[model samples]
Target: MLTFKVLAALLDYPNAETVAAIPEMRAILKAEGVDAPVLLLERLERGDLLDCQAEWVDLFDRTRAGSLHLFEHVHGDSRDRGQAMVDLAGLYGRHGLTVQASELPDYLPAFLEFLSLLPEAEARNLLGEAVHVVEALAERVGRRNAEYGLLLAIVAGLAEGPAKPVRLATGDMDEDIDAAWAEAEVRFGAGAALSGC
Candidate 1:
């Protein structure tokens, strides 16, 4: 549904394009009866473009705690994450979605976009697999009082069952956490290492 796309857009890096889409996103959220994402949309609408972009970078780009990559929370920087990336890419392919080389399949915005193309029940069912990631991220972002948390809560709310509990590593410095969960490039196809698979 467009609601998923709107949520994805809100989660992505803000730019002039994102700002231009606010009215339509607001309308889509209202039409879908999803009220929470509208708060994020409204915040985006009110904030200065550069300030919004800077906040997004500070929260998502600079901190592992607010990362948009799903596997960052699930598998950290382990080799298994590479295989998971390949598998998720294959999943998208099966559904007729071609992920651009610039974006990882597990990136939250890309995943949400993938969901936007599916039947509502199928989308929610598929989202169930990542509910824990969404919930954990929501909790972390909410602790900072970020409006982005509302968007994640909306996603978590759409899942069919309770989220599995997640345990985040504690007592680590920010740089240490970033170093530990740092992202690695994912390659596809034969001789591509299957990402160490």
Candidate 2:
């Protein structure tokens, strides 16, 4: 059985006051003949539960390379589950993106669209705060043009409802858009551009 202390620590519970409350956790680990507490501590020390800090570093690098498509997928799927939005925002912050109230209107759509994938209650709780930060960032960056504008519009539509129509460009603008975004990333930083979305 897993030790209550181990499970509590893994879950970041306030305190593993007693081992009795986590009987099921203990039983499951015990049944598996696992030394739950030791394993948990080892994983924690090794940052395994943190899912490889280097992975996140690689993710950040890919994001800078403009190759990280997971965020786009997550943004697409975030209908009400705010966790994805929160995670993305945290990543942005970690990468030194400045999220502020002024930037909210521009970036809020994307943030909200992500939150939308979460439960309504979670979305409701997260939307306001997330929007506030996004707005602040937008204000810092000023207004958006075609590329950023379109991205924001897409995010906004998704947040408001599913299957919202978006008018994205087709054909030859891909290279131009990529170049523009890359230049912007170099100038403003990837986190800022992402938050601007």
Cα lDDT of model 1 by residue, 88-129, tens digit: 999999998888988899999999989999999899888888
Report lDDT (Cα) of residue 188, candidate 2: 69
User: lDDT at 22 for candidate 2?
Assistant: 42
- Give residue 188's lDDT in candidate 1 (0 to 100): 79
The alpha-carbon deviation from the true structure for residue 9 of candidate 2, after best TM-score superposition, in angstroms, is 21
Cα TM-score per model:
0.84, 0.22
Taking all chains together, the TM-score of candidate 2 against the true structure is 0.22
- RMSD for each of the candidates: 8.7, 16.5
Clashes of 1: 0
Model 2: per-residue lDDT, tens digit, 1-197? 12222332333212233223345555655674544444333433444433533433332223222222323322323452356546666755654564565432223333443443455455545434333222222222223223222222322222222332332222124335345445333556558667757
